[model samples]
Target: MRSLLSRRFRATRAVTAATAVLALASVTGQVAHADTPAVPEFDDGFGLSQVTEDREVHSSTDFSITVTTPEVAGQHKIRIFLPSDYASEPGKRWPVTYFLHGGPGNPDEAGTVEALRSDQMITVAPDGGRKGWYADWLMQDTAEGAANWETFHLEQVVPLIDANLRTIPDRGQRAVVGLSMGGFGSMHYAQTRPDLFGHVASMSGGIDFGNYAVRGAVVATELNLTTAWCAVSSSRGCADYGPVVDSDAIFGSPYPVFNADHIWRSVNPAASANLAKLADTGITLYTGDNDLVENHTADGVDIVTSRLDKLGIPSRAVNYGDGSSLSPTCNGGHNYGCWAPAFADYIPRLEAAFAAEETK
Candidate 1:
């Protein structure tokens, strides 16, 4: 039964073909928290094996880029797969999808490779920032913490990939997906830069950062801001732990607005006015039944769905019966172990969407 399900998860040719086309055309491209190990190192020639004739896998230890953000310096390594037809048919363009790793600290090389093997699509994962929420600073002084992340991604990373790799060059061919912090990043990127990605997906994402902060799931010290605004606006002096601020002065009036705005902009699909843009671009949302962060996931889905409905934008959401958030399998939890399968299941749908767009 498990094997059968796995087979079902594999990418179909229709999807593979579309992905290949988008990837080829996208010359455009495009994180951290830590104390955790730096992104993992892989063998230079590592690649995925095709589960089917239509799929092919490729991995490169050299598939990496480094960005020196104003606040932090980091390296991003990526693993990619090109469909069997990609090399054979040199003239084609393929759509691209980025997979984001959870934990902000975890590296996504292996699972990314696995998903590529089954899907025969272009995929990449970059390490998230050192334990930060990938936000823009609320205040200029706190730019290092979260604000720089946006610059690192939009300026440093995307341009590097487009210059270095054989990929689709336009935003219409690109998509983003991730788990936990990565999931939040995926949605946040799509909202912030609708012109850069065609679709976005979040799996058990930490989508409600405002709620999390309010609940104290996020430590005050980890936040670097005089108020959160300062953190959002500037990378310097952003860590609450690094420097003491007069909270009495900074916390009350405008800081909360920045916090609310940040959250509202990041996951509140309605706030970005991008739902119509997503409908035009083919965005998708998904989560598991047993995602560890059930409340956030549910809220994300509900909010996006409600917004999309009001805007009359067509979208799809999936909830696997498996409740475990760590494993991708039926018993896996919210981590990669659980998301890999969800990714596998979604690849075909993604491909089909791409294919449909191409024909039109």
Candidate 2:
């Protein structure tokens, strides 16, 4: 039930930092809400389902937790990589950084455990499933049930990390970061649950799923909603037929189906009513210039940053690119070339945040 370093995926060499990048242009938009919505309560019980050790050259204590979802009856896996010094430091409580993987994750994915082990904070990576997107799925079949990733992570996983591991266990000590689909998940979580995370970053992620074009392309994936997120290929198609996707999934299908105004009111971070709630939270968003397939990613960063600016929320949005215009160290792409360095650079910021909290 547990994996070792022998099961680790070969680490890809991290690319250099981005030297050249784009900046999001100024934009004007009305924020939907001034205060965040209330956090729903859930039954909380977390324990280590299992644990394993890997003595590979770069190995630490590994954890496997089985979480039960709200509607689903099956157990999901959550893998964790403790700090390299965890075993030696018996009484220390390290901070935690949650790392979310992209959609339709590779079956053999071992996460960035090896690359991030050197950091002092524990790295938590959960199996969000091929299409979970970290959102509570609407139970389509009462018999089988849906994957309630949101509840499992917030209610169970976070508590388990604190109870079982040497963790600071404070909201100010927690951080979350992700790439692509995981990026969207990170922002959504931070926006929805500001009490749980102090810092959040999204690299090459889609934050504006309310946009029909963005929604259509994302849901077009076999893992997402398939044909449900779209009726025709055009944004206008959503106007005539309401939303093409099921209302039960992701956000509940409100009455006004076709209008994005209702569908993403509670979900889309960039367009949600609680967008201002992230003002106090540390926000870092970036995307690669050469991410052709997900070109809208950078645009999503722009949308959130713009809204944050209007609400007086400070954030940094970097547009990384290949060394063409400036002395670029990081290459622009959707793969490891961009994500690796972004993650590497972010860890220090997380540490600093925790340090600042300790002083206060």
Candidate 3:
């Protein structure tokens, strides 16, 4: 968590990828949290076998699970937050909210969900990988063959929760929310598998990757320096973290001059086909005027918000002007301060979606 926050604050200023990686590379060893000891250690989620290292986090309320599946290499870590009354009411099933974190991001980013104090909704957060971008990579070597995030989350994680936990197991009982890159994943997952997630919300997520180079560059840079790549790198007995690859490994190229651009367009939530599938899924998009690199986000969230309006997709739009005031709580840009408030506002809305169906 220390490295994640350090990288975030510095990255907010448009720093180079090398600088960002170097800044946190040293601290990456301090990856696991004391309260949550089960979290993956150095080179976590980037493809390192930390399965035996798994342990429960936050006692009975919030626990972590290591899932093994063919969707991606390495052991997957998921944090599950059960309702306080879960043990008291053994037969009572509950609604679920899937929380996705950002690049170099963890499932419990900034303790966003914990701060919400919960809403009688089960919170299931899966490691979307550090910059996994929640997609199966276009190339194997691109992500060092450790992609397949979408399949892992939807096919493996989702079912594992439903079967093991007392969840409603219906689309109306499920919602997905994420910040930054996970934001893109939530919206795309909902759009692609409308039957899986009934409601979806994105916080400062990059919805249109094709329109902005920064979006692609960010992904490329993060992918290049993955933990899996670093574990094998010729390090001087230190966490090298990466050998420094290129965007080509992930998408072939950052721009649309080549065929790889099509992959970007395809995964984009704002794309015509993607948007077309959202008619049945409740959609919400959020971004702050004071957010870091707000312009690049506009090409994503803002444009998608506009397109949603134009397409008449039932959606909620929160500008959270400058991320000020708690009246209608809106935090600052891409940071957790912004996300905590945004999440505080969105969680109830998500529960309401589930409640609506429950009453029916």
Candidate 4:
């Protein structure tokens, strides 16, 4: 009888040891905090086979995915932030937010990634082509084919996310937000593809792409390398112009709205023609009052908001701070510092818009 009791006791201790180890694992597996969801690295929604991921270039919450599309040159890299439960709950669907980075920036910027690290939504940042302006380039070539950044995002990236990830996959569940060049991109994409995104916000966005002065300044500053090949050796009659200024790649040359042949009229958000299209969608614009580039940033917001008002379309435009919106606290000055706060403030409003649409 004593021997029998010892065997039972030993079994109980073994079970207890296993249980304790499991409890510790459960605690450590939580991604952020105890309450945070623990997503799996691979699931029906995402896996190593569907979109190739770079493990080396990742944060605690973010990772990179690469895919090749017919629209642009070579393979494109998209940085994605999956919520904690992303892998843990395979049956759940989440809203998606396409975050466009500013000009001269790419998907790997830590500051931008940090801004979105804790977001519960599935956040995606595409390769903005550095200075691709998120538009289809005129005829830039890659080994695969002509570079079409716009088509890649609209046609390829969105669908891939929907197919591979457990996304809501509806117009009302998606939002687009951007800063600087990305702001222009968000506006362009939202207006062009109203069926894709429900809420659109631009923080110090290049909204008024048709503004000649602004476009000129942007082209000079961003694409400053003057190439003689553009002016002297163009069989297509394309001059050595700033990508937006004279090249047919963007708005088709001759700068801002020529009365006779305004090629850019339809796409120019600042113009009455394009602003009219955003009437039904949730629209918001923000800029720092002290932004030196207010002529293009805050002023663009003012111009577009005024046009929307005239058209009887509801929109919100805010110019924050009275002095140079430069912050000693944040990076400030038309950069990620200002952009981070703008995003924090804007996201709640965007979520409210989504909720309102669901009720409707």
Best candidate (score: lDDT): 3
lDDT per residue (tens digit) for residues 214-285 in model 4: 565445533434331111111132223223323454544535444622645656778887777777778889
For model 1, how does the per-residue alpha-carbon lDDT over 226-281 read when each residue is reduced to its tens digit?
A: 34322211113232334332222112222355454343443444453645556565
Candidate 3 lDDT tens digits, 83-144: 77876687799998898887666665535544444747888888887657788776666434
Each model's TM-score, in the order given? 0.63, 0.72, 0.77, 0.74
Candidate 3 error regions (>4 Å): 1-53, 110-112, 115-117, 223-243, 326-331
- Highest TM-score model number: 3
**Model 3 TM:** 0.77
RMSD of each: 13.8, 15.7, 13.3, 11.2
Residue 220 in candidate 4, Cα distance off native in Å: 2.4
Q: Give the poorly placed runs of model 1, Cα more than 4 Å off.
A: 1-62, 65-72, 84-90, 109-113, 118-120, 139-147, 209-277, 289-292, 321-328
Q: In model 2, how many backbone clashes occur? A: 5
Return whichever of 1 and 4 wins on lDDT.
4
Worst 10 residues of 4 by lDDT: 228-237
Q: Order of candidates by lDDT, top first?
A: 3, 4, 2, 1
Output the lDDT of residue 181, model 1: 59
Worst 10 residues of 2 by lDDT: 9-18
| Candidate 2 residue-wise lDDT, 1-360, digit = tens | 123442231111111112223232213332212132111111224532422121111223554444555534455666667766775676778888888777556212435424555456887777666556678765454322555778767776788667656788777888888776778789989988899998898877768775566565554442235444322111122212222344345554433457634645667888736678786888998776654434577778777788888888888887765513322444565665556666666667767877888889
